[model samples]
Target chain A: MNTCKRIRQHLELADFMAEDSFSLAIEQHLATCAECRRFQSEMLQLKHLLKTEQRVSAPADFELRLQIQIRRVRAEQRTVWLPWIPTPALSALAVVVVCTVVLSVYTSIPGPTGISQDPTAAHKPTPNSGPVQLVQPKPLKPEPAEGLSLVMAATGSTEPQNRPSPRSNRQHDLNPDKVLVLVRDQNNTENFVTVPTVIFGAQPVINTNAPRTEPADDAQHIF
Target chain B: MSIALSYGIELNLERTIPIESASDHELVAATKEGDELAFQEIVRRYRNPITNFVFRMLNDYDRAVELAQETFLRIYANSGRYEATFSFSTYIYRIATNLAISELRQRKRRQLFSIFTPWKTAPESPEDEQMLDLPDTRPLQDEDLIDRERRLALSKAIKTLPEKYRAALVLRDVEGISYENIAQILDISEGTVKSRINRARNMLREKLQAYL
Candidate 1:
């Protein structure tokens, strides 16, 4: 800003307070400019009148009454969280806190098994949203329902059968009710896994809890 | 927030330090530590200024004194929350200004209600009650008449100033507070304080052209 503009800025509070006085630049401006001079003089007089108006003081027993009030307030404050807050307000607050704690504790308990425990299940495609496929899947099994899926061993049975691949995804050209079993295992000597027919996107659930029985002979082809 | 547990076990601060010489922050700290002497010192220091400040805002001595006492009680009640960031004077002034503003708004609401309902008996104002208590019987001299008119005109001019500008102008010009402190007390920018003060003073100058 230019000199005059800046000088007027300082003129706002100058001489308004007892110790505040005009700067040399403002003094020079006021000395030369009649408008600035008149403004300052009038403000000075107005401030004088404002200061001269009688000041009000507290009553003789202001402190005494304040002390009693303080005690009363302190007594009320001791009865609750705040002086003006009623019990219902606190009751509402308590109810909210209790609900939050109970909900948090309930949500924190690990869920029941068989209800997708994998954290990455959130990122996977849901069965209804997209097609689910098995590794080396066979042609459509038209006999089954829409959600029921079938898996077959890719190689001979001695080799571990690639189960319905979670990462395997393909669009099958069959009816919605019939999901295809893509591969066939020719050799019967296998650690045969029982794949439960379930919804197409459903992960292959092997009941690891069931005791394993040794195959008594090579002819025992377990499904 | 209430200073919950400090009211019990009155402690004396006379031996710790001279209460008069203690700084405002130190007194607040002492008050937080349950010292009544420090709080009394604070009251002694601010009672008159706060009463006058609220009086200027409300223009009613009785209500001003009552609100001033309420302001102190609040300060004592909330002393635990007092931070060293702002000067104790600014904090107390903020509280006093808020209390005065609330009282003004309540009075405005009462006036509006009275205007709307003619059947309801009107309540006596502080001014009417004051006039009833002290009848104006004595004749005034010429000098007193002129001075009284000037003072009345000044108070009227200030009261007529908008709510936003009144505190800034009073704190700056009449109370002699610094611009920065006034900004803090009013919770406004320093630029806003300057503009408000300028507007308030210009309005006053126009209203009191004869006196000027």
Candidate 2:
């Protein structure tokens, strides 16, 4: 190899020169060529200076200062709005609290005054005449079977008790074999009425202990 | 990782393993578990090396120390996210390098701004002139002064290099880190690290030829 090329290789691998044949050739070249030898020496000096450059030691109070700063930062992190709960979890908790408060308030407050005073007001018929009244079909003749009479009596008592009473004189007209009667109000509202059949000789008498009223104000038509 | 417990109570638990003997990843794991001593050990281990690396990069001792402190603070804060995929040294050095680069960019911006602003000079009063005329009684040595000047010039030359080349060269030559480790630290390939170091060394040699 030429002196310059060998010198360049020597400079590059100066630390790894272990007397190999190639390195020996570079050494021989360096011995003869003064310029290459100078280059090699400068490269070695540069490497030595770089390796020995003074390293700056950390300040004496570095550890103490760093620890204090870390403590301060961690303190700041801990002082968040809700320390134990994460942001999303805290938000969810807030939502739950609001919803529970709303529901409790809604349930604790009393309902409308009229409905609160009379719980059955919803089932009672109103004084207003505009609402349509649905009438159940009346049985033509009450069955004489005891079971049928008991069933009719149980079902009839469950209706609203605000219906006008039937006339006392009309009780005699009911058939003796039929123990129950179908009564219609003056508003054409049909209702079931249970009556006991009284057998006076061959005729049946319904002894209804109701007070009769005038036909205009209160009238119940028995069908 | 380092919890700030209430009432200012600091625990000084005895270490199971010496800080020097434990691997960096193991220490990092201990730090993640809220071991205060482990975090202290990490800071003790890397503080000097990081300070030197940043000092060479910025050529400002005070700023370099400040940035080195910030590097450890970042490591402590982000310890929970630390994975054991790479060496802890690589991770911490990467943090230091990034902070140093950011500081350099800020310095460049300030320099640019100063260039546009008008230079304000205070007129020298009689008192200031009298202070400047004070005599120098201390003897000066030529050899020490020349050595100091050369070192100063060398530092200036390294500062003039582009940030990438300077980092590679300092990490490889001064810090004695292997090319593979430097690659992991800088997030670059080993070949790129080698090329940058060689180029940086050549540039420095040219600049400091008179000292050589």
Candidate 3:
């Protein structure tokens, strides 16, 4: 590096001249060049003046004042909302309130009420009722020039019986009409079980003596 | 003494921890956990340096102290959110710098407005002249007076520089912060910090050449 350029760089970074190796070369240049030497001296003096400026101390009551201020701020934050809930707790409370409002709105809407909501009310038998009977599969009658015909009995005991079978009358003690039937296709055996279609808000009472269908035990009840 | 006595138990606990040996980030972490003693320690450590920095920037003693207190308040308020992404010193200094810059901008706006509206003036009376003359009772040694004048002149020269340069110079020369750290505090590159500091020092030197 040339003497003038090197000395100029040294003057700009004179604060680190004491520790840097470039200081030696700068020193040699300053020893010979009077202008660069004066520049270096002036820069050092400026640095010294800047460093010697006294630091102002905080007032004596600073710590106490700060502590009090912090306490006041914390107190204000705590009481920011009514009932003084902290931020985390307040967030959780907000979530709970929103969920409750949503649930109440959902449940209070006018719709078909599930039977399980009031099982006792739904189980009471109506006054106009007769024993519910499950019709037995009659022997398949072969039509002339046609295959055997299997007849399906209609859902309630309102259908007329062809023959008053004694077994049909004996199993009429249990409420068989209320039992929901779920057909499980096992081994492709087409055992047809009819389920009574219940209209919402209409209570149909059927006093049944038939045993409850066992298949109803495995069925998923919507109610 | 009042503060020490008021928080005596906390001070005792703080003493047990040896605050001088703790790192800035460690103290900040403790403060984050709601340790009042650690917060007090942090205030005690940086309060004076921040006061001086703000004093140089604002050139008002009362405002400097007030702003320094505010700086600590900010640190305490934000302790929970303070991540050690940079050094604690850098973080605190950045807060102080921003506050000082904002105050200066407000002062400038006020000055601009005052220029358009004439300032209110009270009539000068004989009593006012007499009051002005009845002074010089306080004793000041020659060396101390000269030192005070020199310091005042230096401070004025520093204030003349642009705000960015002044901040960089104060942090580097007066506070002895490294260029890299000053860069972090100012959110600038180290090269920019170095250039600002050098320019600031050279400008001050040029302005105060007669005194030198």
Candidate 4:
């Protein structure tokens, strides 16, 4: 450190000596070098002045202000508990509202949009050319049995009987006021059989206080 | 065998107990456990030294305070992830010095878009202007014009230093941190730290040769 270059390094070594641990070479050189000592003294003086001069007075309410900020941040963290009230939740709510409206509108409208006012109009049978009349089977007449007070006719006997052909076998069994009959026919090598039996019983009446429409006189074939 | 076993156990316990004299490690560990009070205590203990460090580095009181607070806030936010590998002060001051350098760069960027103009008269508060005129008699021998001039010359010389040299000199000379710690803070080698401080001192000596 007696050399000018080594003395410069020794001056810098003063910065590292605060912890009181240094290489022996630097310490020995510092003991022998006057120039390095003077340099170290200047650095020490400057350091002292700077320390005394560089004091920064923080704002009076710094901690209070910082605590207030932290509290505000914590409060913000606490406000996110309500999941259903977020902006995206509003979008989800809108989809539900729209679907409900569409379903209600769909249920209220009678048929497919703009097709027809009557829902069954597409399935109504077309008018025929030969005769608009429907062929009906013979009406069943009520026969009162001996033990029963009243006899009732069957409600539906609406299909017409086909034309009779050769080699037919018909059997009839007549009772006191009712008849049981069976008919068989062979036509186009196919068999058509019919058996009719009379039944008599009174059904209990149910009284609903509603208007009753008159029954249609003509019994129409359904098929 | 018993003595050796006890000695081994003692060594293990010693290793388990961290270096408590190094308060940064303790503070970091406390902070990692989500202890806000402990963190605040750390801040209170270190605020003055940090303020002193940054105030010298940046040469502005308000900027230094702002940067110091920013540094502390960053430290608090990152405390949960802090490792106990490095000294706490070194880590934090490194963050502070980096922040200061970033601020300096931003100021330089803004100045680039603007123009440079030297103030013929430095704007001082009324109180400071009054203090500037008042003569000190607290130490008659030390209060001489030559001493005041020398102090002023040294201060001005420091202000003229480049940021790296100024920071190196301020941390090493002014803050009295060890070179190893300064090296950690500056992210430089100890040799580089010594070189920068020497260069800064030599520059100051050359600028104020007459006063010395």
Top-scoring candidate (TM-score): 3
Runs off by more than 4 Å, candidate 2: A1-10, A13-22, A81-223, B1-15, B118-141
Ranking of models by TM-score: 3, 2, 1, 4
Score chain B of each candidate by TM-score: 0.81, 0.80, 0.79, 0.73
Error of 3 at B211 (Å): 1.2
Model 2 sits at an interface RMSD, in angstroms, of 1.4
Ranking by DockQ: 3, 1, 2, 4
Q: Tens digits of per-residue lDDT for model 2 on A95-146? A: 9999999999888765532112232222343444112111222233443332
Tens digits of per-residue lDDT for model 1, B1-212: 22222322237523444566778888888788788878988999999999999988988889998999999998898888788899999999999999988888898898788777767554467654533342233545687887786787788778878777888878877788998999999998998898998889889998887767
lDDT of 3 at A56: 82
Give a tens-digit lDDT track for model 4, residues B43-111.
777777787777776667788877777777778767767876768878888988888778777876875
What are the DockQ scores of the candidates, in order?
A: 0.57, 0.51, 0.60, 0.22
Clashing pairs in 4: none
True contacts kept of each: 0.80, 0.69, 0.76, 0.29
Error of 3 at A26 (Å): 2.7
Q: What is the lDDT of candidate 3?
A: 0.67
lDDT of 4 by residue, A1-223 (tens): 2375765565565553452575676567668877766666666665556555535656666556556656665576578656425678889989999999999998777542222334223223334211111112233233333211111211112222332211110111112221111111111221122222222432233122322232121111100
**lDDT (tens digit, per residue) of candidate 3 on B77-163:** 889889999999999999999999999889889868866775636425754353234223344569778667667668777876889
